[model samples]
Target: MHRLQPLANGLRTDHPVPGIPFVDDSHIPIDDPAAIEAVICREGGASMGRWERMNEAQGAWLAYTADPLRPELAWAVRHHPEHGRTVLLLLTKDAPLWHSSWRGPKLLFRQGGYWWDGTTWYRPDQAWDATCKHFSLRPVPDATTITAADILDENARTDGGRLLDVYRFDPEAKPPDSWNEHLAMWASQRAADARPLSQCVVRLSAPELPADQLIGVPKMPNIGDIVAPTLRTYIARIQRELPAGDG
Candidate 1:
């Protein structure tokens, strides 16, 4: 059984208080604007009834993952456009998070930057904030659009390592995911080749937003009532491996 752990600073986000309707504090502040935009866009705007419903479903699952008692081995946030809703997929080790090492175990698909504006799924650069009460639109790329090269350069400036090395990409490749795939494949190859595994950082494009906005809203849900007991145990095992500190 997976064991559950308390949410660390890195994973905690602001959320509404339960059983409260239309309270002022219900609208929690997200520290990182870009991150908030990612979450909001992923949620398809707060005004959408579908988004609210999806949030309710996913929020319950997250609460389960956050439980200190009940735990999950791996949980996925599944988006279903047909129903205009999202669901959580809880799996045991029989189904690992990802077959590949480079990818995270779970997937949350929504608007992102890589595609043209208005398309589902966006790359981080494509996400933007518009002046709206509880919603925003994806911005079209313009002269000011942050390019992959620009992202690489910024990382190089901030960190001593070259972005190319960090991201493991070829400059000539179009549609950067090809490079991302190459890096992933190479890691898999190395693992198979019996080479000592070395830590390699990968540079990813992310949206620009405030700290609170990036971190999400905070709230605690009753997970014990929702998820299976064995899954809860699995989460606890993983939580024990995490670094101990404030985060």
Candidate 2:
């Protein structure tokens, strides 16, 4: 039984999407670009690296985290004067994920995962805007392709902190089952209509497991439901993003 706990200033906590934490948010500052940049940068802290600004329009600036996770992953913030708050948008490289129609839990391929539109948490396919008919995809600028770092992340592990025996290599060094189950519970969909974030193993940054572990990447499924298009578009975008054999 998971739920999104609301914060004081009309904001809420992010779902513990696998591999990520129950990360908090900072308020949208003054309308200046520098202000927005400073907030995102400060919030990201040491866990995240430099961010690459992709595009800005409609008072929203889209920037991708230079961290090795992927190029398609980025955060967009738009200031709505009426609301007096800027909307923090977590968008994939494709169309605003809500428009992608892939309404499932977060996956390694379709990482739109889940988003909170200041009021409601929306699945990839759950969002609809009467005002804007076609939500066009953002243009990805030419930049160096980002990937996970070769060295282990300073704070990558979600597994309860346990010192390992350096003498031997054990890939499946098990953590307490309750620990896994506890995070597993939070990882799923929180709302009554939303289901748990099951189906895929924690992949990026070794979400559920330790970095020393060796688990293969989740396969990009070729078929999905009508409202849920397959990861073909996801992979296609990645291919477009990377040079010839880079992806």
Candidate 3:
């Protein structure tokens, strides 16, 4: 039997239904009779069912990655009052093309919110918007290769060269306590350079595969299935640091 874990911060009510162990404000509550019945009538089950179905559809893709790029996914997990969890899923047409044959697809996911109540996710209205602003994405011209250095170089050559900034990806792992420090450094440098940290534009290092030769359209996985373990880990870490309550 699965055990329902306690929420670190008192953000969610701890209510458990068999099969679905982690029930809290992060999910649409099942206790409301009207909402429950509505869900059942329309979708046959509640949020868990919906999650499962979504997971199945998303999991079919050959390459799928998810991050809190969109407000919906973040809102789902953060349970922010003003802003909903927004998520973005990227599905690759084929294996990521890397400049170095030794380098493979390296996907990284990050979670963010305005307030961390030591356990649960929270955000003031202003804070929520500010956070959302940082999580925006922009399109770039399709190319065969892209690197942080290349972006900086492009900006240097452009008319708005002064507006450019340099961003670097950390390859080494660090302790949890150092995360904020690293982020602060990165943010400070970017700010000093006057560039907004935005979505990464991926470039292919090889020719595109013909559509006829490709398999089914790649799909992205739902947040629940793709990062449930990470979510649970975050929940546990918050519980350890904050007051005990259902999250």
Candidate 4:
């Protein structure tokens, strides 16, 4: 039996929902977006006249790669009619997804930039305050505790080398066997909770909002600041690995 391994940060490894068959390498969704893109691009090269092909080739060279075979992989493909594009998404199984709920009439945490609602990331600024309430997920309604995991799935993977703090749920109890099913049910709720972007608000985050609201805002360190503590720890590790004098 496959068991979840605990990480140092307290999040458990994302384990697949029991009994879901692992997709074999030979059956890696040939009709998927990546394969389709490759086929279309290759055919376009063959069909076009030499001179015309050169111009088209520039745009057609968009490349995509598949993830290595893993039993834990779960994915979804989405098509955006407005953008005329297909998006491939990977998701984790039995992971503690973030979601928000209303608590009375007030919108809580206005300063929070991004709120994860287990399904998709939501920008609260796009929402009308009166229409929403506090941002909280009822992971297991009525349950005293819940389990949380590091969401390293495709749609919600992290690259900062820093895993988020483990959000503890009821760790003692086993989740419902149909946990994935529960996630699907939550999807529609999240959609209903979402507010369309205002006509005047083309940008998701604005200066009127908190500083953290602005994605990609660089941290401006004080003049007195030194190297980050994490970097110092890495230096110590390197010294230990090197010859005494060389370090």
Q: What overall lDDT, based on C-alpha atoms, would model 3 receive against the true structure?
A: 0.21
Error of 4 at 182 (Å): 34
lDDT to native, each model: 0.22, 0.26, 0.21, 0.22
Higher-scoring candidate on TM-score, 2 or 4: 2
Q: Tell how far residue 126 is off in model 1, in angstroms.
A: 14
- Candidate 2's residue-wise lDDT over 27-59, tens digit each? 333235454344333343642222222222234
Best-fitting candidate, scored by lDDT: 2
- Model 4, stretches more than 4 Å misplaced? 1-68, 84-91, 94-203, 208-247
- What TM-scores do the predictions have? 0.19, 0.24, 0.16, 0.21
Find the 10 residues in a row with the least total lDDT in model 3. 93-102
Model 1: weakest 10-residue lDDT segment is: 16-25
* Cα lDDT for residue 233, candidate 4: 32
Candidate 3 C-alpha lDDT tens digits along 1-247: 0011211111121111011111112233322323322332214432311121122222211111111122111111211122111111111111121111101111211111112221222221122236656322221123132223333432232221111111111111111232223223223333232323332211122233232442210110132233333333433445322111111
TM-score of 4: 0.21
Report the number of the highest-TM-score candidate: 2
- Write model 1 residue lDDT over 1-247, tens digit each, in one string: 1122212111111111111111111122222223222332214443101111123233221111211111222222222222121122122232132112102111222111122221232233223346543223344343122222332322233222112221222212221222333233223323242322221211122444222332111111122232322332443355322111100
After superposition, the stretches of candidate 2 with alpha carbons farther than 4 Å from their true spots are: 1-15, 20-62, 65-114, 123-132, 135-247
